[model samples]
Target: MTTEDSARLAWFKSTYSGNEGGACLELATTPNAVHVRDSKKPTRAQIVFTRQSWAAFAGFTGRPR
Candidate 1:
């Protein structure tokens, strides 16, 4: 999606992000894809991944605590 489109989604950051001074990721989930971006630089280009791809990545990463 374009940056304009991504701006419309509700982005969420990990709990650890605050503690680490924004050194973390943020995500916006949509029906078909998940949007990922750096918490430190939200306006930068983000990565868009299919729901299935995101799920596999989450599984491999073991989900953030």
Candidate 2:
């Protein structure tokens, strides 16, 4: 996505992220994609994943390790 497109995304961080942040990430979702970026560096490059791929990743992470 272009910088302009990224700028239009409503990015938000997890509520668990405290004011005294160490390593936090932000996410924005669309019908087709999920955008992820470092909370401390919003201007940096983001990682975009298709909705299906993101769902799979989320599901995997939720499973017991």
Candidate 3:
């Protein structure tokens, strides 16, 4: 990803992300897409999800603290 893309990306860690920094999910919002990827591999192929689908997933997963 280019610096512009990286800079434009606003990433959020999954609620389930471990405090110890193990496996974690990173979320980034784009104008027309949402980017999902492993924190451990920020440069790897990012999984793109639509806004609606992402919302559905978040709802389905729910918040489990």
Which candidate wins on TM-score?
A: 2
Q: Kindly list the per-residue Cα lDDT of model 1 for residues 1-65, writing each as its tens digit.
A: 67788789999995557665747989888899988899888889999999999988877956676
TM-score of 2: 0.80
Displacement of residue 35 (Cα, Å) in model 2 is 0.3
List the candidate numbers ranked by TM-score, top first. Answer: 2, 1, 3
Note the clash tally of each candidate: 0, 0, 0
C-alpha lDDT of residue 63 in model 3: 64
lDDT tens digits by residue: candidate 3, 1-65? 66468656889998789799799999888777788988887877788888998888777856674
Per-residue lDDT value at 36 in model 3 = 90
Clashes of 1: 0
Cα lDDT over the full model 2? 0.87
RMSD of 3: 4.6
Best by lDDT: 2
RMSD of each: 4.2, 2.4, 4.6
> lDDT per model, in order?
0.85, 0.87, 0.82
lDDT accuracy of residue 44 in candidate 1: 95
